[model samples]
Structure formats: structure tokens, C-alpha cells
Target: MFGYVIKRHQLWSGKVLLFPLSSSCASGASGVRFVFGRASAAGTERRTAPAESTGQGEAMYRRKMRGMYISKRALRKHFDPHNYPRETYLLCELQWRGSHKFWQHWLRNDDSKDCHAEKYFLEEIFEPRSYNICDMTWYLSWSPCGECCDIIQDFLEEQPNVNINIRVARLYYTDRASNRKGLRELASSPGVTLEIMDAEDYNYCWETFIQPGVYYRFSPENFESAIKRNCSQLDDILQGLHL
Candidate 1:
């Protein structure tokens, strides 16, 4: 049997005694041997160590919370082009046969501190996926830039099993001849279909792929109006580019 004895009075009296009883000792035996020590007043007073707060740890926790909040907010505004009017946002929906569930990724121009969204997705999301037959549809607020166009071309060349369809709200064409040529080449790439999303396609993507539960007031009419406005803006830009 193992037991411990604590004497609070002895501790208060500036003396504490401890003794280990032998197995042969009876339950109610007296004359228990003990080691005694005199306690100082300072020693009797309890002191608790204060908790150490780390600035780096707190900063990291705050950053994590901020990232989660931003991601949640991004999900709600994924289909709304007004959130990042000047920048591009790409939302990819991946669906496989025999599965009702789908994997979705939202990539914004400034999502990463170092790399663009195309590189970020290629390195983080695409590299980790196992070989499977899946259809990937990309919904872009604006057509991919020249650099991203190249990346997509290379990715498609490597992953033949995965088919890609790109639907854009606005055409990405600049006065730069190289950019105009790259966009044309990308549109004509094999195993990839690139098209400007019509009103029906826009509504279908917003209602079916985006966070539909959060937007309770979302309607097809609103989506159609937004698509028409975006199309007009795209037309003006395209006309300016003369292509």
C-alpha cells in the first residue's frame, strides 16, 4: 500500500515532518518515525510564477484568426466581382464521377505574399492531388494574365486526364502585343475550353458553386444584371485593344 500524509499545522508552525512506514507496521500503530525540518516564514508563504506571454505566439494566433476570417469572407464574396474590381479572382470547382461532393479552391491575385495565385495553386493544390479522373471548371472574374496563361498551358500538358474549362467575366487583353497574342494562343489550346461566361453560366456558377447557403437573397435576376454590366465593361476594354 502507498500513502502520503500532509500536516498543514506543522507546515504553518514553521516545521514539516515526513515519514515512510514499513509494510510490517499495523494500520493504527503509533511511534511512526519522521524526518523533520524547520520552516522559515518566507518559505511558508506561497508564491506563484506568473504566466509568460510571448509576443510572437500571440501574433501568430492573431494572424491565424485573421486568415480564417478573411477566407470565410472571401467564400461569401467569391462570385461578386465588386470585391476585387481591379484584381483577378479565380474559383475552381473539381468534380469526379460517382461522387456528389466536389472540391473548390478560390484564388485571388494577392492571396499569397510571394507568388501569384496560379503558382500557389500549382504548388500547393495541384501537386498534392492523386491521379483521378476529374473535370475542373475555372470561373474567373477576369481572364488569366499572360504568365498564368503559360502556367495553365503547361499544367494541362502534364495532366491529360484532367479536363479544364475556363469561363471568364472579362477578357484580359492589354495594348501590349505579347499579351494579346498570349490570350489568343491560350484560347486555342488543346484539351482546354476558354469562353466568356454568358448570363446563364454566370448565374449557374454563382448559385451552384459558390457559397450558396450564405447568400440567401441571391437571385438569377441579380446575377444576370451583374453579368451584363461586366460584359459591357469587358466589351469596352476589348474594343480599346482593337482585338
Candidate 2:
């Protein structure tokens, strides 16, 4: 996950300064577009301002600024959809020895890219660590499937130093007996913690990591209700299987 903060310039011209908060993006950059209005005012219009320099300096600066703006906007637009309805993507945040790392991976149902998020985490992040203890928290748009459960179960059995905490948008279960058994197995894991994500968790991730500028207005009570509803349905399915 990536985010940027905006800095406003104190100008008497009533124009608000907006710049990409990233260091790499801000390097060698000049003036950006300014909005002429009060901070509390609505529908403020933005107007382009001339670069502070000309010739090679202006051209190179604009090129870098444009690339950063386009890339940041494109990433937000492309990944925002994956966090809902589709539930095909997963993001992991790892905290170890006062350092934090993030990894985002997606799973496709039929394609060769059917790699699981856990496998990616193990191969990319966990393998490189020299420390023995690490805490891994997963922000999954959908719960793990049966195959994923088996893979993670084997992993935890081998690596006792890792602790996993999973917060998911929704559960994915079926009427199949194997699926139900898998869910039970995953829930019974000793070193792993799993739960439906609450609004606080959602808001924290949204503000601190995903999109710093946008506020997530979802309520914790509503999220709890959704979890209850999903649990009720899962209970009915499990009762039908008599397991």
C-alpha cells in the first residue's frame, strides 16, 4: 500500500498549492497547479501556473512531475476496485524488529498466476529476514480457500517463529464438505488469529496506508452485523454437513 500527503502553500493570491508528497516525486520539481479559494470553501476551481524556470529545467521538471502524478493516480484507480466485490487481491503488512514492510499480491482462479498470498510472503519477505520473530497481518478482500488453508497450515507447522493475524472483508465458503473441513482446520490453528475486519481496522488501513487523504466512513457496528450474518449462514451450512 502507498499514500501521499498534500502540502498547502500560504499565498495571498488565494491559490492553494498542491504537490505530490513523495520525496522521489518532489525532487527537481517546480510549482504545481494552484486552487484559488478558502480551505473550507466548496467547488474551488484550480488554475495552472507557470513553472518557476524555463528551458531544460522546466521540461525535465514537468516530465518527472507528470510521471509521478499519472503513476500515483493510476495505482489508486486500478487497485481500489480489487478491494471490493471482486475480492481477487490480497495485501500483507509485516512488522519485525521495528521495521515495517508491505507486499501486495493477486490470485487468479484459472490462470497460471493462481499463486497464493502466503506463498508470496514466505518467498519474498520471510526468507530474507535474519530475525527469528515477526508478526504478519493480512488484509484480505476474501477469506482463504481450502487449498490455501492447507498451504498455510503446513507453513505454520514448519515455522514456529511467525505469528499471523488475518482480517478479511468476507468469508468464502461453500456447501462442499471439504471446504467446511478446511475452514475448521484453519480456525483451529494455534498460532494464527482470524476475524472479520472491523471498521476501526478498515479506517486505520485507509488513512495510514492505502489513501491518507480519503476518510473511510464505514461504521464498526455495521461491519459487525455483516459478520454476524455471514456467520449465521456458515453455521447453517455446517449443521447440514453434521460436522
Runs of candidate 2 exceeding 4 Å displacement? 1-84, 97-112, 128-131, 214-224, 231-242
lDDT of 2 by residue, 54-116 (tens): 111100112222221222232233233223443234445543323222222222121234455
Deviation of model 1 at 149, angstroms: 0.5
**Residue 176, candidate 1: C-alpha displacement in angstroms:** 2.8
Error of 2 at 13 (Å): 41
59-100: candidate 1 lDDT, tens digit per residue? 000111112122334433554544446545565666443333
Candidate 2: count of backbone clashes, pairs at least 3 residues apart or interchain: 0
Q: Stretches of candidate 1 above 4 Å error?
A: 1-84, 97-100, 111-114, 128-131, 209-243
Q: At residue 241, what lDDT does model 2 achieve?
A: 46
Best by lDDT: 1
Q: What is candidate 2's local distance difference test score?
A: 0.45
